[model samples]
Target: MTKSGHDILKDRLRRAMGIDLQTVGHNSLRNAVARRMRVLGIKETRQYYELTERRAAELDELIDEVAVNETWFFRDDTPFTVLQRYSRNWLKRGRGSCLRILSVPCASGEEPYSIAIALLEAGVNGPLFKIDAIDISYRALRLARRGIYGRNSFRGRNNFFQRKYFQKTKAGYVIAKHIKHSVNFIRANILAANLPILNSRYDIIFCRNLLIYLDKDNQKVVVSILDKLLVDEGLIFTGHAEPGAFADSVFIPAPYPKAFALTRRSAVVCKPDRVSYNRQILPPSLPVQPLWFTELDTARELADTGQHEEAMECCEQYIRRHGPDKEAYFLMGMILTDMDEPRLAIRMLKKVVYLDPNLVKAIEMLALLYKGLGDDNNYRVFKQRAGRVAARNQPAGKGSE
Candidate 1:
């Protein structure tokens, strides 16, 4: 059986960009190819494929279409919180004169901008830190450089950052000049032989959601690249589904819950300096809460660091004090899942869903738990419910993952 021209193009794309067809979907490849073909007025697949082989610029255009550019500011809030804490500690230690951070596949600037905002909220001024944001897509880079964003860029419950950092105009909100100046956006592929930042090492790197889209070999390649680019005690933040890619590497999960941070196994743990909690760093409009509320965060940190027993104890203590809080139950559920206690995790997750029926994460967790437990009927029920909840919660014009 002979492979089609399209199939060969897929192979080419994989080699050129390390994209896993299974992860990104064949439809995306086909759509990108079709789009490029339409632009060039090439009707034949073989003809377009030959052109891509000869012309690197055409191939890059195809890649821009195929790349997923869906992102919002502070997509996962925990990572920024962890970054603030880490930055505070870094400032205290004074290891380096300037803190260096990298955001690979920065995706239309939200992430790197969010990083700037997070650092600013942590009292890290422009002179004290440098952010280098990298992305392959020229289209995304243009938008990032423009530094103006619409509603789609600002999602989730916390919108106070918008009020503090953005000036609303008729043409969407313009990011603060200070925040824009803090980031240096670079257009380059991570898989390139001559990566722009090969000579540079970073104290922190946010390479989230990229590994999940790459093949096993490419995942390893990326991990190696990250290891080389990161300092000994540096932290790397990854997407929720991406940690498994680093299991065979020297990277270990950092003690930060949903932050999805990893550090080198040989990295020395830096003790945090004793600093008073600053309420201003959090959401501006949020009312101050009791100190005991931080127990759940501690539990999550413990769980992330693989202290399952202690995490469970913390969750239990929180539950005893707070009387059946949804957040505590969710944390307990995750901890149980980490401990390989699926049944117990399912029970906790069920309570979380009961307390807040619209909690999609808890619902999805239940679905996964049921599937793991070999209960197909319950799995389907929860999976469908999770889908419904997600659809209801999702904002308009949001791209599907």
Candidate 2:
């Protein structure tokens, strides 16, 4: 049988750019392709597939559709806080002549710029540090170079820094010239054989959240590259959902909050709250009740669909019946989060983490909730825990939802 248009495009994309369109869901890929076709005035699917191969510009556009570029300045402030502290200490000690930071797949430059702002605010001299930011998308790179962002990039309660660093204009908040100059933007593929920065070593590498999109083999490849890019004592920071992928690597988990900083194995130190969530501790192999699992699923669906009260009720019933069920409590916490009750949500989520410390999502949400409440210490602590658990529990080669 002839392959469907989506199947053909999916295979082509997987081969060309290592993107699994099917993994993102068939409908999403189809719709994106349809939109691209409409924009390019290509009515026939077969011709568009050929165009994707023959025309580099067209292929880039399609790849942009698959690329997830959702990011904000100081998205999770924990890492920046860690960076600030580390940079200050490093500078004080005179350990390195200059601090070099790399932000791969930098996603419109929010991260690297945020790093600049954090370090500068930390009293580190602007010229003492340099940031090299790279992304696969030219469009995103263009925006990053422009250094202007709208409301989408300015989120959460931390607008103080934004107001300090950015000048508000009709288009959006324009990043200060000094911050923009501190970061050097480049366009390159992470998996390319000749990555632009392969010869250089960085004090810190922010390869956050890029690995989830890759398959298992590619994840390994990307990590290997990052390991080489990092200086012997330098750190690599990842997303909350990525620590599990580094279990066997030479990187040791750094005990910083939601920073997901990993150091060389030889440099592992006793971090104050070094989490050990990788130990697979499942509830004993006793036969699980199907009905209870079904209720948990129902509650999760309800919460996801914004039926917070109904979900909470379902979770409450489960907890009452099962006696502090981890999943139930976690669902309750998520529901509370939807209901805008951060304290209650934190209580339930903390319970969930205590019951099963490897509940990655619970720990992550707790971090966010704490951040909302301006509890910096707890926010970083839970964020770090979440990264460890996420690294342990995340399946190989799946994209972020």
Candidate 3:
């Protein structure tokens, strides 16, 4: 296909599905399209393009090829902890008859199932809650409804939850009956014109790691749709890379450690540092630590807000005061990446891995940077290391706001 033909194909795909083919990588998009042509016995790129426009089912198959569905049960455990507290408080207050939760693009069902298990452990029974899990990929939704997962889905330090909620099978871990029954999986696209009109409001919604894949315009559209689907004062949980996307939205970060949950903005203004919503809150006073320790969080906040220069300065101050903390370096590396300084970003990220070999994120970033730079050898090396480290001591309880 000519370059113009490829560009046409990309534009058609972006219009069909709100996903930007560019984010999936040019080579990957072309490969997926070529692979699909072979599968359908289509002769040429133009033929496939026409089929994609005419046949919705074929377009969905193409989306499945490029979709990134990497997730695990209790992937980040802190949000579940916060949900437990939220469920308990809702029960205590008799706020509503039942809690309604939504997990859009609930890849492989790990997240929604995790929420159900957490609510169960918190004494919030099935009668008191309902979880709706939706995704655009029929392939993923099929696997989710099967309620079985492999070892890769059971990563991190939450084996107890697995043991309690899943039955070990020769094939994989089959989710327990009760846990599997808790969530309803539906095939729906968030960008569909009628999505908000079709779905009822939810008390809490989990739409993590999804907006980062979308371009800015689509991100705003999805955010607005989410806002409409949420009840007033409802909470939303997003991925670490997404706080900046919501910086201008109708949400405020929930006050909890490693819980990247946000509450809908109401008429009354709420302070960021106060977890007033969580009744059983931990006091802010920590046993007297150096002022520098507190500065790390300040630097992280600055970085999260996209004040890269200010955040870098804060990290520099911390390094001068304490001489290179691993977390500080990792944060600095992330800030530099956002600043489009790949060389400085690579240096900082490498320093993070040198200081703490188990820092999986730093290694993963290094692999991506190498891949972007066409350094296939280093990319493969760091990618392997990242996977190994991730399998062993998968970090938890730390993410964006």
Which candidate tops TM-score? 1
Clashing pairs in 3: none
lDDT of 3 by residue, 122-160 (tens): 999998999999888888898999998999998868668
lDDT tens digits, residue span 15-120, model 1: 8789898787758887887888888898888888889889999888988999899999999888998788788878877766899999998989999999999998
TM-score of each: 0.70, 0.66, 0.66
**What lDDT is reached at residue 154 by model 1?**
91
Model 1 ranges with Cα > 4 A deviation: 1-3, 273-401
Error of 3 at 56 (Å): 1.4
Q: Give the distance in Å from residue 326's predicted Cα in candidate 1 to where it truly belongs.
A: 27
Candidate 1, pairs of clashing residues: none
How many angstroms is residue 252 displaced in model 1 relative to the true structure, after the best TM-score fit?
0.8
Query: Model 3 Cα displacement at 97 (Å)?
Result: 1.2
Residue 311 of model 2 has an lDDT of 61
TM-score of 3: 0.66
Which regions of candidate 2 fall more than 4 Å away from where they truly are? Answer: 1-5, 268-401
Candidate 3: lDDT of 149?
Answer: 92
For candidate 3, the 10 contiguous residues with the lowest summed lDDT are 274-283
